[model samples]
Target: MDLLHHFPHARQRPLRELLAEKQTWVNQDKKGFLRYRALLNELRHIRATWLDLNSDVVHIGRPSDLSPADRVHLQAALCSLKPWRKGPFSVFGIEIDAEWRSERKWNRLIPELPDLSGKIVADIGSNNGYYMFRMAFHHPTLVLGFEPYVHHYYTFNLLNSFAGLSNLQNTLLGIEHLSLFPESFDVIFCMGILYHRPSPIESLQALHVALKPGGSIIVESQAIPGEEPVALFPEHTYAKVPGTWFVPTATCLQHWMQRAGFHNIRCFCAHEMSSEEQRQTPWMEFESFQDFIDKDNPGLTIEGYPAPRRVFFAANKN
Candidate 1:
């Protein structure tokens, strides 16, 4: 937890201090908060399971290195951390098939982003640091991930400890906290988060402020198919899921970027989310996209809104 070691200039306003300021809200008596912390600490106590860092599956340990008892212990520990929403990780030879096939998003966005090698990157709304770890593959100088949810934050640490990724740091913070950051990042990745914000424009502005001058940003979000510039503002929920505010068209998203003071905005790719891309697995056994989609017509949600088609847009801070 040495924040200063990674960010030497943060002595004036350290990440630990920021988290301390929000201690009351973060440590509120939310369900499973204490248990999640306990599990994370317990995981840290476990002996390091040696593994490779640069692999497609995020290999954590060789199967032959562990005894039968060790494998069982590792599986039990990992299972305690349920509903892993953002990964498809291989830890200690056990495949934690997460809810979302994140690799698909990575595959789409990587081609659209600038080379991350030696770049200081930040992943806003980093769920369990999945994309952050993937970003490390490009050999970034440093990777900082911000996740507000305590459970996901702890999970990120547990995985980082197991993976031994010294270059990556996952902090318990949110996009709102980005205002406290200096204009330091070379690149920022914002995915599956814009629609969740009540003020998407302001969120983009915060991102714009956080980036170094001439830095780049990658935005990926659900899109309502259309050519005209428009965004769908759902009343309460879209696809029976809450907190989904505005699903914008690609053109609409470009306009938001332009409004946020970003130049060279480009909506590079848009693709429909598939069942195979997000489904119930051993690690995350819950309602999935199939349940939310219109059974009679797969092109729309059960509520008759357009189905989830994600789009990626890249822009530069001018």
Candidate 2:
């Protein structure tokens, strides 16, 4: 796909150069690229006949589209891309029960979501384009997803190839690339990404710059419980997940936004996560939420920190 065609405004901004750099990095390790290509080759021939992105499962095609042998091939192709983290998608009647029941999180934010008609939106850390596909139902002019992980980038590409959402696009990029898109988006969703950054304030500032004036940013992150304007800098990891730098209280998160110059900040939802929300499934057969928390004390992580609780906040660029 010619990604540059979608961003005419960004054509002169080194976007192409950046994409080239990313592609070089992806191919730098020839062995890894070949391994990834081998898995992707499995789904290159399969395509969905029809799709309904608005549904809970993000239905795609029908079971009858495939013969018995084709069905087996399709399932095997999907399994090769295991650890599906953010969807409950149904592709040609084959259900993918991913680790996270992402619809639950989407439901919590949908009520507060602004009308997306004719808007340009970005979804950071958009694993497998689950949220991007859902956002498409609102008829956004564009829904660009940034997922640097090779597995997710290809997973989205395969699904999009089948579903053929012209307005939905995935890029092998991450939050660090947002600077190239200054004032480019109408709405930005930065979910499950903040805490991973070592500098939350700087990350928010980058997000601030990426938005057009008055554009909204919806943020969702793992948070701790407290009214104090403080954050928990984990000694090593949180909930057994590494790269988690700081888990802030809801108020602290709001304060971070204020410092970053966002206006009309609202911390709307705060809910404790549970195994029911994110657990192991056939598609994602890895240790999950249940294993991350203490066996005896569910209120704390196995690392002895407060258990995982997620908070949603929305604010607009001033």
Candidate 3:
């Protein structure tokens, strides 16, 4: 829970002050997330001496190179955290086929990103630090990921330790808590989480406050395809995922960004999600995107809302 000690010398004081302000909440979270204490202890047994950082696969180590006993131990420790939703990692010898083909998302987002060399970055709603690992390839000064879920937070820390990365840090915090710092980050990535918030505009405002002047934000969100600036407010659920509030078009998102004090907004790419991009895999044995869409008409969700399409936006704070 003492996080600032992990930071570099220059960042320690500011981060330490922030943590001191939130010490009580952090203590409660430490207790809440440490429920998987046994599995976490077992994870300490994994050791990876080899690494490939720049590649799309992000190979940790070869499984065949490990003894049979060690390989089994590695798999057991990883599988203990089931329903893995964000990766397709090759750790040691086992291939963890996660629910989302995150590599594809990485490829799509990378081309749109500015050069991140030596920049401080924040990834909001970072599920298991998939993108944070990818962002590390750019030699960013630091990559901080905020994930509220306890399981995903632990999973990211476990994977980061396996990767032996010093530049990336994952914390068990929510995007709403970005208010703790002002003008702290150079780039903020808020992906696939806008529709979940009842007040997406306020969330964007918080992101603006967190960024340095002229800092850019990369927003990836679920959208209902259209040229008009409109948003869908589902009565209850969208795509069978509860808590979904709004699915806006690309134009609507641009407008929202402008209203939230961002300028020079650009809709880089908007694509419909394919079934291959998300499906139940060995690591995640649960319902996936396909299950939420209507089988009779692939263009609509079970609730008869528009099918899932995603849009990426790049905007700057002025």
The best candidate by lDDT is 2
How do the residues 162-214 of candidate 1 rate in per-residue lDDT, one tens digit apiece?
77778898777889877776676889999999999999999999899888888
Q: List the candidate 1 regions with Cα displacement exceeding 4 Å.
A: 1-11, 14-16, 22-31, 45-55
Off by over 4 Å in 2: 5-13, 27-29
Identify the superior model by lDDT, candidate 1 or candidate 2.
Answer: 2
Best by TM-score: 2
lDDT of 2 by residue, 1-318 (tens): 665654555544588788888888877758767766665576566667888887778887789878788789778878888989989999899899999999999999988897799998999999899999899999998999999998899888878877878999888989988888888889999999999999999999989988988899999999998899999999888998889999999999999999999999998899999999899998888899999999999999999998979999999987
The per-candidate count of clashes, in order, stands at 0, 0, 2
If ranked by TM-score, best first, what sequence of candidates would result?
Answer: 2, 1, 3
Least accurate 10 contiguous residues by lDDT in model 1: 3-12
TM-score per candidate, chains pooled: 0.91, 0.95, 0.90
- Model 1 residue-pair collision total: 0
Instruction: Please give the lDDT score for candidate 2.
Output: 0.88
- Give each model's whole-structure lDDT: 0.82, 0.88, 0.82
- TM-score-wise, the better of 1 and 3 is 1
